[model samples]
Target: MILLPTINRSVLLVIPKQPFYDWSNKLFPDLEPTNMADIDEYNSYLLEDELFIDDPKGELKSYWKKIFLNELYEQCMDETTFPALSWKLFTQWFDFHRSAVVSDLTSDPLYTDE
Candidate 1:
C-alpha cells in the first residue's frame, strides 16, 4: 500500500442540494437535471489549514462569497440568470462539507493557476 503525503491543507466539498436543482430546472427545463445520486461529482476546494485553526466555522465566511460565485458560474456562466445571493441563500442552495485535514497522495509537486 502506498502512503499518502501529508499536506497542510483543508478540504471543503461544495454540494448542490435540491433547492439548487429546482432553481436550475426552473431556468432551463429542457436541460438534464442534476440528481442527488451524482452529488459526489461536485467540487472540492483545498484551502490552507491555518484558515481553520482559529474558528473553523466562522473563518470560512470570508471566502464563502467567492466560492458561491464560482459554483454558480460552473452551473451557468450567465450572471444575469443567478439570483441575488446572500449568506442565507447560499446556505439554502448548497451544502458545505468540510474536512480539517487533507492528505496529498500524489508524489508530483503541486501547482495552481492563480
Candidate 2:
C-alpha cells in the first residue's frame, strides 16, 4: 500500500452563525433562512503551516478579510447586497475552528485545477 501523503498546511474551518443567516435573509427575503444547527457543511481554508508559530491571533486577523468575503460570496453573489463588514462583525457572523496540523488520509494523488 502507498504511504499517506504529507500536507504542510494548517486549516481554518468557518461555520456561519445565526447573524449570517439573518443578513442573508434580509438581502434575499424570498430565499429560505438557515440556522447554525441546521447547517451541516462549512468551508475549510488551508493556510500556512507556520500560522500558529507566533502571534496566531494576529495571523488569523490578517486573513479574516479574504475568508470573510469568501463566505459572504458563497451565500450571495451580489457584493452590493452584503453588509459593511468589520473585524467585530466578522467574528460575530461565524464560528472558526483552527488546526495547526492537517492530515491527508487519502492514498490517491491530490490535484488542483489551478
Candidate 3:
C-alpha cells in the first residue's frame, strides 16, 4: 500500500510479515517474489509515512511507529548489520528507538501519507 504511511505498530503488526516473499509469482505476474536489491523499494517497503488525524493529539502513536520503522530501514541498508538481522528486526528496532519516537506528525504536507 504505497498510499499509506501509518507507521503505527498495530497497523504494521497486522500487515503480512513478508509481503514481498509472501507474494506468489503466479498470482502477481508483474510482482514476482524476488530479492529486493533495489534501494528505493527497500526504503518504501520498510518505512511508513507520518500519521495525522483530524484531532491533533490522536495521531501521536502513528508517528512514533513511523520513526521506529524508519530506523529499522536504515539499519537494513547497512549490508554488514542487515545480514544478521531477520524479519523480526522491527521488534529490536522498536525497542531501541522507543525513546526517540514521538507523536509530532499532524497534518503535515511534507510527510503526506501517500
lDDT, candidate 1, equals 0.79
If scored against the real structure, what TM-score would every candidate get? 0.82, 0.85, 0.21
Q: Give the TM-score of candidate 3.
A: 0.21
Report the lDDT tens digits of candidate 3 across residue range 1-114: 444344432222212134323322334466645433332232222223443233422444444345444543543444333223343443432222112123335566444476
lDDT of 3 at 21: 33
Query: Which 10 residues in a row give candidate 2 its minimum summed lDDT?
Result: 50-59
Positional deviation of 114 in candidate 2, in angstroms? Answer: 3.9
Order of quality (TM-score): 2, 1, 3
Q: What is the alpha-carbon lDDT for the whole of candidate 2?
A: 0.83
Cand. 3 Cα-lDDT: 0.35
lDDT of 1 by residue, 28-83 (tens): 88888877666668888888784553553477777788888998888788899999
Candidate 2 clashes between residue pairs 3 or more apart in a chain or in different chains: none
111 Cα displacement, candidate 2 (Å): 2.4
Q: What TM-score, to 2 decimals, does candidate 1 have?
A: 0.82
Better of 2 and 3 by TM-score: 2
